[model samples]
Target: MSQNERFDNNDSDSLILSFNGDANHEFQEINENLGIVRDVIRNLVPLGAIKVAEGIVIEPVVDYVFESCKRNPNMVFVTLYYARGLQEIDHHEGDSVGPALRDMRKKRIECSELLARELVHKFNDQDLLFTKVLTKRYAFSQYDEISNRKNALDLATRLYSEMGNCGAIFLSDNEVQACVYALWSGHLVPRISRTFPILAVIDYYIPNHNLNFLENFKNLELLNIPRNQYLLDVFSYIMFLIIYTMVAANYNEIRELNGFLEGSMYLLVFSFILNDIRTLQKHGIKEFLYFRRILSLILHVILATDFALRIKHVTSFDHSIPQFHRKALSLVPIFLYWRVLLTLEAFQPIGRWLTQISRILKKSMSYYILLALAFIAFFQSFLVLENTHKRHEGDDDHLGDKNEWGIFALLVKGILNAPDFPGASKLENRFGFVLYSVYVFTVSVILFAVLLPLFMTAFATRRSVPEEYLAHFAHIVIRKVKHNQPTRYNYPSPFNLLYFTLVLPISSLSIIIGHNHIRLYANIEKFLTRIIFFIPMIGFALIETHFVNDKQDKEARDLDLRELPGLPFPEDEKQMLRRILYGLNDIKEQHRSLHFRLEAIESQLA
Candidate 1:
């Protein structure tokens, strides 16, 4: 007889002792793993299981699906088990998988014809255990079905006696659902899953998690395998959270830290993939058991970092200095673009205190306020134009003029022409006179061709002019120029608030009037440096805000549309509570028993 048979048939007392020792070690490992599994289950499972269960009359479709799968080893069950196993293997040691495992036996071969003694012993010793151990490991939950028995104790007895191959055992849906429920309910400790799902469950708990519950599975625990996979998931999730938090700080330093976050997330994802492949090889199926766990971690890290970087760049920016000071400022244009659409509507709570006050007083003063705003808008545009013109004529040395601005000096230096400006600077080379000329020409054309026509149209006798709209549009334009003032516009000399209030407005208006008469706006110096850098950044920010608003609107509309379909709506709070209760339910034994028989038959055929 083979050594394995000898060992298997040996005296029971010593074997029992050895088994007990092994079981103890295994239990310790599993206990450690359970900590992680519990976290994952907590994150993944829905919180309102109890309430959902109450409302969730097990539909005929779900029953049919469950029953149908029982007669045949369902793809879902096989896939989940196999995938989980492979992932575990990969996590333990990735290099040992794939071609390595397949070729390992051969690597130990020592002779051309004779069997390597170690290979013969290895095969003989492991083959029996491979069959029995694998079978027991996978079929634990389905032990009853494997033995064609009712009770778990009976099933375990049969398994011990029949000593079947690994392929005969399969976990049932009932067990998985039960375990998930149990974990959610705080009864059972999670053993296999990761923490991401637990967090998802928590988020879900916010809106809905309650359901009607029939069974409570709060005391379950995996006594065999370690929960290392779950631990890894938790570790990765924590890292992802850290990365996201740092990003949220809205500092340049956070973006600079993205490289570290990205690298760590990538490594964790890579580990998960390897784990997945290994599980496939060992379990003989594919499962996403760890897929989302890894993905969630990675996604959170990447998005958080990106968002933080964006916030930092946006909040640190000050538009009040340099050329922008003299110009009026509007947050809308600064952040608007097709790719980065933004709108004040999208950001409702930004300055709602002022907004609320305006709204409250709107009925009494809106028309007058609007009229005054129109004047402000028009006069502001004219003042900006005048300042821009004066700056162009008076400044021979752009560097000297930029230096005078102090804090804004570095930012505005590039707009000046290199060859014509007194000091040769980097901006002159990067943006030559040609680019400047094009910008100047475009602005001149727009002023004469666009604004002039619009102004003339306002004076037309037959048409009722919308002076308010013109004022608002002009306001936006002049506001942009003022916010971007230092790049091209000259500030009033006295620097006092009153002096700024009067001379700036008047000067801006004079430039427009003079341009209308002489077409002298054409001769105005190039503002290409301002055009290139300022426009895109501001435009992009505004566009981003708009798109965000549009997306939110579309989602609300979709939700409203769904409500029109006449589906019964559950009480949100009860639903959430039920989900939590249901998540803790355990029916692994029932599911495993039903599925094991089918899997055994399939295994026989194979």
Candidate 2:
């Protein structure tokens, strides 16, 4: 690619990974470098071997002899020449040689493969050959340190030379290199999955800022994203839908998995949405909203297609091996549905949108269409079963026969896929309007109820809670009150409508008690269902009411405390003291009563 077309390293940064095309040339150069490396290694090995042996054994022997003969004049000369040569090589070759080799590579100096093999052998040997070179070069009585460092440097240079990049290895020392194998050997699958989105975002969308939607995609690059984050999100919506549909199918397995899957997926969805909001904070709100909307649209399309296929696959005319799955395989689509729903819910607006009917007629239309499809499937199944029994001439022989239902399916399928004809076209026209009306009504209701409320709540909170107010609120609720716990919902403000929704049950307890009664339940199923449905609602309501009420009274309580304490004393204001003391006593009594009631209710609930 041309320079302009090449990946941008700024603004719209691109990961432009290019490989060296001149592989033969690069290999030849590396081999040549290795030849020179071998010559250096061959010289160094003997020196290293001698030094290691000397450092281990000879040093002590020399010291013992020297200390016993300290007055001897010859010992001084023996030490002098040894010290000088050691210092010379330590300064010249040991310190500067590695850098000089690197510089030679930069200068494109060619070496031979023979030299590479020689160096590799010497370093690998780690015997007297390696130690002697170090002892001769350093002239140090102790050659262990010199031999170790030289061998390490050789191995490092060889690896880097072969790799071409050597970026990571060259920066660290030999000890670091040994520890790095653990990281290198680890599975890259998870990392690859996580990075895939980032690469896709940059490749497909980053360049077209006018398509500016790509800014939203940048949030995926967060390093601390939860494990199997994408898969978890997918699981959330899928599990939810699976349980929902399987409940209709009367599958016991569905119910069992539902609770575990639902709870985890819910948390996953919340985390996903929370992350989205966190991401939005980096970008402007408008862009954030746009990015979220686009993502939602994409998710919705995928979910819709999945659901459509599931219906078609399950309600097929003939069982030429179930297209989707043979057994609990249908649960896959169900799980997928749950994942999509939960993920969408992670973005509060999207979740709410799925539940709500934008227009009254739209939901009615969906119900009608659903009813029609169900009727057709049911009738088709019935006919196929009947026909199969008739062909077998005995219901007893064809227990699995379902051919009677095929006729109905064939009819329905024919009409659905019918070609436009003079008479058939007229029939289609009559039904088409009704179908369109239903679609419009359903879509409108969904938008109005589900999508609108969610967006409104989110936007309202964002607008109402200015940063200054948020800071002040945080100071009061978080710092001063020491209620450092985050709310169930990470609302922009405490004054959000969501708080109202949470508190609704607590505020209006009579509404729940009036219609719902445990006394009439005939089975645990109904009782558990009712309780499960209301538990979170009731619990959240209690929390919201308790907090919100306390929040409201806090200011007045502070004002009273601040002003009451400063009032004139009994000597100057007898009447004031009487009123203030009596009031304080009354307040203490009231507080005690409230605390008693709270404790009693908690005990009962428990």
Candidate 3:
């Protein structure tokens, strides 16, 4: 019979008391059974038979081992070895059995001094092994559960103290989001320092950090990633500005530069279209057609029309007025400004605040609608009064003059304060004069007084506990961004669209035909696709090195100093030591003074 089968058939009382009583032969048998069980577990796949073995064999055996160690403390070294094997198995299985192991440790099965040393040695060895496993696993799969990710981050941080670049691997999107969520939820800020290395890398890649022309340019170089969709929008907007500046200056000296700009603008427009299509696919038509997206669509239309008009103006033989082309180009800046505001949605804090503001405005929409109706009513009243008391063509007071009570002037003056009091009295129609007075009284007094307080109340009611609200908002943002599958979020312009349409599907089919190993196939395809685009990325990185400086280390040091609790002052070593001594002397003097005052009080009491 197999050893496992023989062990299973053994009496439970014999297994338990073999270590408890003085049965040397039975003790040897239990030790052999443990060795066999360990061998079986060590050979099994991490998540495979080991889990079954853990329940059927390992748990009961561990309990027997613990009882035996308790009865004969000299056997504690054997228990430690068994614990080490269990930990190794757990590590391979992603530490899912950690709680059970922790419970076993808490039982505190007895041990001798020599065996205790062995346990400590085992613990140190396991810690090093766990750290290595965590560092490697985090680099490959950071999207795991939060607890595992946190442990990995802690290990990375420790290793980074010993080896500089080891921590950079933990700067994945999942890690950053996790850190941000922790900080915003009132966790200590120092926990996020682990991600600083990666943040520095991103900062190096995209220098300005702020959303501007330079940042858009950097993002353009990263067009292979899906998260840079808004960056493409920003780049297109900047290109519009560039084209506008060129036309306004009438500088056509560098044809090559202009051609490059034009080609880049076309590419950005294509990227914008593909990004929009992706958004539509992910969110569906109803949710996709938000106000900002619609505004973007309108801007693209304007750009397309402007581009066509400019092309016609350039290609035509006749040098005509070009009025329409100029008109269309003039509208570009206005639309571009709107797109810039839309791009701010990617920044978490600002985006959350803007979303709250939008919600408030939506809730208060009826108030604004009523105010608009009131204005319309007042405007119509003023218009009718001005027409009824129309002056003759040869009148001394010209109607076009600023002081004249024209329709707009009357409405503005009445709504602001009251229509010119004397001018209303001088009107030919008494009924018009009375109508103007009532209109001013209704708008300037009742409407203004009522609406101002109503809006204030609405705003006040929306106020919340700032910290809790911020924490909640941050949690939502982290979850949303993490789960949104932004790994494929970027692909530059024409090439990205082609890759999605042609390359991805063909590769997917090949994988299905070969073995139906979906994950392996997808990973291989992603690696190959990224490798193809990485060539240009490398060139971009080389060019970027010229602009990016070595000042990040200094910046990181400054940030560290700022995070320290006390107000820190820079000084030479001698001066700092002198200051510390002086501070100690001051504390001594204060203590002496307090003691003297206490003696005086006691003497008076006696």
Q: Which stretches of candidate 3 lie over 4 Å from their true place?
A: 1-258, 289-291, 311-321, 345-364, 378-483, 486-528, 531-606
lDDT string for model 1 (415-506, tens) is 22222322222224333344434443443443345344444443441121122222222222222222221122221111123224543455
Alpha-carbon deviation at 175 in model 2, angstroms:
62
Tell me how far the alpha carbon of residue 246 in candidate 1 is from the true structure, in angstroms, after superposition.
1.7
Clashes, model 1: 105
Question: Which one is best on TM-score?
Answer: 3
Off by over 4 Å in 2: 1-327, 346-349, 355-362, 365-402, 419-606
Q: How accurate locally, in lDDT, is each candidate?
A: 0.31, 0.33, 0.46
Q: Any idea what lDDT model 3 has?
A: 0.46
- Residue-level lDDT of model 2, residues 1-606, one tens digit each, is 567655454325422222233434434443343343334323433322322321232323333333443322222222222222233354456545566444333222111111222222222222222222111122112222322222222233333323322212121322222212111111111112122212110100011111122332222221112212223334444554555454435545321334554344334334445444544554346533333345544544444453445456556655543343224344345344434553543232453343232222332455456546654654554444445445556444433322444344334443354422232222224442344334335434543554454555455444322221222221121111111111211222211233335543443653466636433422332333234333333433333234323211222223223235555433346336545755786899999999999999999999
User: Model 2, residue 566: what's the lDDT?
Assistant: 57
Q: What TM-score number comes out for model 3?
A: 0.40
lDDT of prediction 2: 0.33
The TM-score obtained by model 2 is 0.17
